[model samples]
Each structure stands twice: as structure tokens, then as C-alpha cells.
Target: MSVAEPRRIVLFRHAKADWPQVTDHERPLAERGRKDAAVAGRRLAGTGVPFDLALCSTATRTRETWKLAVHELPQRPKTVYEERVYEASPGELIAVLNETPDDVRNLILVGHNPGIQGLAEVLSGSAEGDARERMTRRGFPAAAFALVSFEGSWKTLEPGVATLLDYWAPSE
Candidate 1:
């Protein structure tokens, strides 16, 4: 928490939603998905983490999840559309994250599953702790998210270094 330190980035996958028949990217949140996202938002808001900014994919489900989750926060965070996130791999996400500006210290990225979970596991150094174990076993359910702390600047990121601060989902 020093002035010289860079801010942390937290990654979240959109909660359970109605998988749309139209297309994968066009899906919207189901009733339960909406409720779960709200609950998760409230829980995240209580953490006292301050996200200076947020980035989300253009997918309807991802967009909706970000809105609902941010609602519980004390202040609104500056947000942007990351077109690349719709089907981004962990490597792609890390690339986008590293390209972010230096002024931003804390950020939230809300996206989809598998990819997000993949990123979390790849970034975390070891798999001994409860968080790693749970991730390894469950593979991140819908609405699942992980708070990771990274060393060095956001522009200089590599895999297997970010520390997992917490992981949560509606089920647990």
C-alpha cells in the first residue's frame, strides 16, 4: 500500500445466466443468475477493496454481471469495453491487463468461465492452499471470481506469480 506500488487486478467470471440460443456471446442473465450476482456483489463490496477501474466483455451476460456487481460498491468505478474478452484465453487477458495504464492501481475484470479460472490457476504460484485446491477441484463455477495480488507493475506481468487473495462463488 505504498505510493510507489502498482494497483492489483481482480478477475471475475459472470454468474450463472441463461445460456442464449442465439449465440454464445448474446446470452443474458437468468433470474437466478441475477440474484446470485447481486449477492456476490454485496459480498464483494464488504471486502473494502477499491477498484479504480473495471473492464468487461461486450457480452450481454458479462455486461449485466458487471453492472449488478458494481451496484453494491460504495462508488462507481470507471469502466471500459474490452472486445477481446468475449472469448479471451488467459494469455490474452494477461496481455490486455499488462497494456493498461500505470495510473490505474486497482481494477476489476468481469468475464466468462474456464478462461478466468484458467488464468487464476496459471497465475497462482503453487497449488497447496485451500484456494488452489478448491479451484483445482471445482474449476470455478458461474459467478466465481478470484482476487489476486501481483508483484511488479501491471505492464510487466508474467504467469505463476500473482497471489490469490480470495476466491468465491454463489455455491460456497
Candidate 2:
């Protein structure tokens, strides 16, 4: 008999990317990004979202965005930086997730995209149309989150094992 693994992975695409004005890694959030992140945080908290682990890219925007979005949680989980996750490809993202500790029930990874979207599209068991479209729409906005469930253990999870559970984006 096969043993069951229990875990949920949440991927957060960093808030809107800054344009030509500043360096990519150093770009600060646009005014709206801050508000959007706060709202997103509240939404996550209000929904009673729980996660045992949190990982983030080392980039400035990702770091800042994650701080804002997760602030609404009643009890913050420990967050660590995954330097490989900075501007990483989908394969790289999956590798980091696969390495997560097995005891965690829920896990969150925050980084930039098209990497995030690429990872989401690759892992999701959801049909190509709706889940992909919604992620495309929501993932990049200032405050958006995607909740997905995978069919296997974090270490064994493959791209097609994931199912898009829910999505939320802060509205203006």
C-alpha cells in the first residue's frame, strides 16, 4: 500500500513589476501595489489560510510584496529566502518546492513570473482553458494569490498532479 502525503502549495506572483525607471531587483512597489498587497493579505487572513512553511525570492520586490501580503496572517509562519528562486524558471521553482520539509501541511512560495505562471500551468491538473486563463489574469496583479492542491507528496509532486483550487486578486 502507498502512504498518503498531506500538503498544500500556494504560489504568489510578486506585485506589478516596475518599469524602466529603476533596477529590476531594486524596484519599489508603485503606490497601488502597496494597497493591493494589504488587501490581498487581509483576504488571505480572513479566509483563514494556514501554511507551515513560506519561501521567497531574494529580489527586493518579491521580498517587499511577500511581507505586505502575509502581514495579515494572525500568526506568521517562518519565511526563508530561496536565492535560486530569483528569476528562476519553472523547473527551478518546482525543485525548490520538492525540497520542502515533509511535515508541513501547507507551503507558500513567493516569486516573480512568467516563472510562476509557467510553473502553475505545468503542474495544474485543471483543464487548459479556465485555470490557465484565471492565473494569467490574477497572478501578476499587485495583490493576487492562487491556491492549488497537488495529488501527491511535495517531493513526488509532478506538474500534472496539481489542481487549481481558488484564485483571488485585489480589486481597485
Candidate 3:
């Protein structure tokens, strides 16, 4: 039997956002956020993980985060802006994953916290070292990302089915 290509899911929480914006969705990334995003991008580029698609939240912060992160990527991946991911719950995020087309193997999700953090927590089957410890301690902080590998298709993904490959948070 031919080996199945591992479905990699990269969960990226938008970098730190400034509070000056009038609305939550209108908020922009802070100075530190830009720096952190660039660093995160460089790190991602080093991994040589070529993403096939990215589903991002419509919020300004999320949009900005994706924009900056992709700058360091070797190749720009196809991106879709979905309003539903703006503040999606864990279940909602799972639904989004389930709806992904089978053709898209490598995926990236750039969104907000609580929801993103919640999704990462529930889906992470196993992790090791300081990364796991940091996740448990601080949860998903701004500019933090969790890389997971799933053996099954996106449609079949469920809690504890994927392994957390890496968790990273860029410092200011």
C-alpha cells in the first residue's frame, strides 16, 4: 500500500493586537506583534513546510498576522478569508476543518485565542518537552503556533487523533 501523506495543521494565534481600534475586529497588530510575526515567519520558513491552503479570520488583526507571516514563507499559499473564524468556538473550528476539501493536504489556521487555544488543546494527542509545558502554563499566547500531524483525512479528524509536532511562541 502506498503511504498516506501526513496532513499537517498549523494553528497560529494572531500576534498581539493594539486596543486603540474602536471595535474588536478592527484592532490592528501592535509593534511587538509585527516583530514577532516576522520572527515566526522566518522560523516557519526554515521548516520548509509548504502550506497548500490557509483559512484565516476576517478580523483586521488576524488578517494582518497572516499577511506578515506569509512574507517569510518560501512560497505564498492560497488563502481564504472566512468571517466565521473571527471568534469561532472549538466546535466551530472543528467544523471548519471537517469541511476542508480533500485536495488541500497542508493547512494553516490563523485566528484568535480561546477558540484557537481550545482547538489546539482538544486536538493535541501527544507532545513533549518544554513546548508542552509552556502550552499548559501559558496557554496559546499571541504569536504562538502549534504544528500537528494527522494520519487521517481532515473530514475524519477528531480529538486526540493528531500529534503535536511543535509549539512555538516568538518573544518580543
TM-score of 3: 0.94
Q: For every model in order, what is the number of clashing pairs?
A: 2, 2, 0
Which rank order by TM-score, best down to worst?
3, 1, 2
Error of 2 at 111 (Å): 0.6
Best lDDT among the predictions, by candidate number: 3
Cα lDDT tens digits, model 3, 1-172, are: 1126788889999999999947999999999998888888888887778899999999999999899999999999999999999889988999999998888888899999899988888898787556677777767889999888887667888888888888888753
Worst 10 residues of 2 by lDDT: 1-10
Q: What is the TM-score of each predicted model, taking all chains together?
A: 0.91, 0.86, 0.94
lDDT of each: 0.82, 0.76, 0.87
Candidate 1: residue 143 lDDT (0-100): 85
Best by TM-score: 3
Q: Candidate 2, overall lDDT?
A: 0.76
lDDT of 1 by residue, 115-144 (tens): 788888888874335876676667788888
Candidate 1 C-alpha error for residue 127, in Å: 7.5
lDDT of 2 at 94: 89
